[model samples]
Target: MTTSRLEDLDEANLSPAQKVIYDQILSGPRGIVEGPLRVWLKSPKLADKAQALGAFCRYDTNLPPRLSELAIITTGAVWRAGFEWAVHAPIAIKAGVSPQIAEAIRLGQEPQFEAEDEAAVYAFSRELHENRGVSDATYQRCVAALGEEVTVELVGILGYYTFISMTINAFHVPLPAGASDPFPAK
Candidate 1:
């Protein structure tokens, strides 16, 4: 069994501030409070701001869901955040990322891509996480394939998911019921 570092807060007993943000999250594009947002709800102020930025990064970004999900899973893979990976990997695939690509990321291996845009996104996310900076060539390639606006949103997606990964990993956020852990013991 997974041991969460934080107690799950009951929605009914929430403080007024927590209730406001909780209600906002419920009514927003997310429609449910789960994963790191639940953990963030412990501090209503943090939850309020973070959830708003998360909503934009997730639902309103210039990058398509396919590429944004790719960056998200890549961050999850790098952080070994099981909750992040388990949640976003399927979304990544459903959004048009190849299963082979997702599998490669799951195993921390380079993926062979069938599309130039996918290759650019994978390279950008992988390099950003692994090297902590993107090389000029990789940045140029990503910008060329995805454009400056999309590339900026890609960076935003990466940064936001990095936050999510840290929350999930640091707080020991449990995966959904019946979901297997995404990463094997390393």
Candidate 2:
């Protein structure tokens, strides 16, 4: 890790409110899972929205894992939500985002693919991330390739990740050290 990133992880400087909740969650049962959600639950509005969004991510039928992860990591890159990128990039990889592809995502680079379907995911996700909305051309291509249900799920997946990005950025969850960090250094 860079000295600068190490400086960022120095927990000694955590805000007082953050420190309090961090300790409570870290001491709770299943701290690893609870920690992130606990931080997001600060606002009732956000918590309810996150719960519904999370269910959609987990249970949505039409979105295959690869495409879902594409939308997720793309939002992570756009938001530069260090912790969001730090967490889900590996899940994307596990769901079949190639190391090369995952690295490209981390560095804000475009994915390379020969298949039109793959290109649609790459293009659609990139467009959604870069523009805060999908381009009509990209949308049409995605719909033609993957159909409307999947296209909607893809957009919803992006919305979910965008929500996560905002929450993680606001409270500043430091990525875990020494584990497989999702957004590995460029």
Candidate 3:
């Protein structure tokens, strides 16, 4: 299910557990997908951990804003979280990411990033998500582009998003209406 649909949601009521999880998400500046889905997760502690981990990964990590945002929204797109993609895409764009780059991530295609640096950033996000971590070669490429501290941040971003995406998925949270799930029945 996509995160854009509201029709299938448990909007009117939430379990006490779900409420706590929802509260944590809503307290943030912008958290589009986390609230409604927390109810479906049926595990408040896990939900909170996901949210906190996401925040720390996105902001507290040493990654530059643009790189972290790219990693996050790409993760969202891969996971088919309409809400996550919708919310974070613009954040990345505003943080200096090009529209082409954002479009590529949304479409599940690799962007033709002319500059080696930009290509490295995109590849790092892709490889990290694909391999669940950077390979030795990919890590070296990432370090060449981003250096060690930022490389660590990039990996953390990927890991955190993976956790959130899986959480959003396993609970079968309802997607907003008209939103497409990138992954559908085989």
Candidate 1: minimum summed lDDT over ten consecutive residues — where?
177-186
> CA lDDT of each candidate?
0.92, 0.68, 0.69
lDDT of 1 by residue, 47-79 (tens): 999999999999998888998898899899999
Q: What lDDT tens digits, residue by residue, belong to model 2 across residues 43-128?
A: 43555456656766755648777777767777888777666766677887898778787788778777776667767987997787
Tens-digit lDDT string for candidate 3 (52-139): 7766887688767777787788788778765567557778899878888888878888787765666676777787667776678877
Name the TM-score of candidate 2.
0.73
- Listed per candidate, the RMSD to the true structure in angstroms reads 1.0, 6.0, 3.9
Off by over 4 Å in 2: 1-35, 177-186
Check candidate 1 and list the clashing pairs.
none
Error of model 3, residue 110, in angstroms = 2.4
For each candidate, what TM-score against the reference?
A: 0.97, 0.73, 0.73
